[model samples]
Target: MLLTKFDPFKQFKDLERSFYNYPSNNESVNGFVPIVNTREGESAYHIDVDLPGVKKEDIKVDISKDILTISGERKTKDEIKEEDYYKVETSFGKFTRSFTLPENIDIENIEARSDNGVLEVIIPKKEEQNSKKSIEIK
Candidate 1:
């Protein structure tokens, strides 16, 4: 049998090159779902999303059939002169994210607010089923 030598450094270099050369689509890409932390309470569910560089007019939130969708676009500045020499590494494009709310949520009472680059969504629980309680035996 013939033995072949494996070069790990060469493989890593190829991976790094590929990462830098990755293509970006001009259309919106829903790659990152917001960091969601669900807390069980007697009244409602609160969701917060970190959305820096997004303007109030550019953000859109929609709800349909128990699904909530959030989308926004961050415009890039065009202040770089032709003679300027430097590196640019900031991302500028459209992003979208969606989530399906549980059945027990009250769709009509859902509310959203944005302040200081953070978005907060409040989903009130349904009164009929969410308010029901069960007795536990010890």
Candidate 2:
């Protein structure tokens, strides 16, 4: 009779199990909050977020007390019938994100749009008081 050596991969099997069986994180409960990148210019600030599998109708944008909130839900597709299965992996759920706008932003002019799974928000800056000035040299 021959004895085989123990495989090292078996030792890490529990780690793999934990990763696969872990519960959803805090973000999942808040909806599919995405990574947001903000760009500031003299005229406006632009915010971009990646949101795949989410529809325009499912998204909701609200502004209250200088706070901007974006929330949406992504519904999972129905199961496909198949005799032979190889692999399947995808995430689908709700998500919400909020941002505190600067005091100089014009909340009434804010606009948001989703294109090709990316959400873009534009916040126009408030007009500066007496921006135009004449220079006098003595």
Candidate 3:
């Protein structure tokens, strides 16, 4: 006997994806999706993307219309002899990820850097301005 976990909405999700031609959150159109982690701090928000085989030059970060997009491609080895490999599981393809910037973010100060195969995007929040004012009526 085999026990399997069941999800009642799995069928509905599949139907929706097929109807709308959309990829699931964990799957990308190119078939390679880099894992990402996000954190929010008092003064800034950080997004960390794990890209094992992708080079820094291949990655691109851009912002347009309040959307931050990260795109890159992972290239395979120059030559691979099929006979020499019993199994190859490495994924290679183009990948894209996007995030919507919050209204309180300081767009001008956004920064991105890559180190040890991790790409970190830092979005600094704008300092809050005191809006309280005294109004005198005649």
lDDT of 3 by residue, 1-138 (tens): 999899999999999879776656565556678999999999999999999888999999999989999999988777976677888666678989999988999999999999999999999999999999989998
TM-score of each: 0.63, 0.66, 0.75
Model 1 bad stretches (over 4 Å): 1-40, 80-85, 129-138
Whole-model alpha-carbon lDDT for candidate 2: 0.81
Candidate 2, run of 10 with poorest lDDT? 24-33
Quality of model 1 by C-alpha lDDT:
0.74
Task: Give one digit per residue, the lDDT tens place, for model 2 in 35-87.
Answer: 67889988999989878778889888899898898988878665864434475
Question: Could you give candidate 1's per-residue lDDT for residues 66-126 as a string of tens digits?
Answer: 7888888766666965347476444566777788889889888888999998888888988
Whole-model Cα lDDT per candidate? 0.74, 0.81, 0.90
Show the colliding residue pairs in model 1: none
Provide the clash count, candidate 3.
Answer: 0
Q: Could you tell me which 10 consecutive residues in candidate 1 have the lowest summed lDDT?
A: 26-35
Ranking by TM-score: 3, 2, 1
Using lDDT as the measure, the top candidate is 3
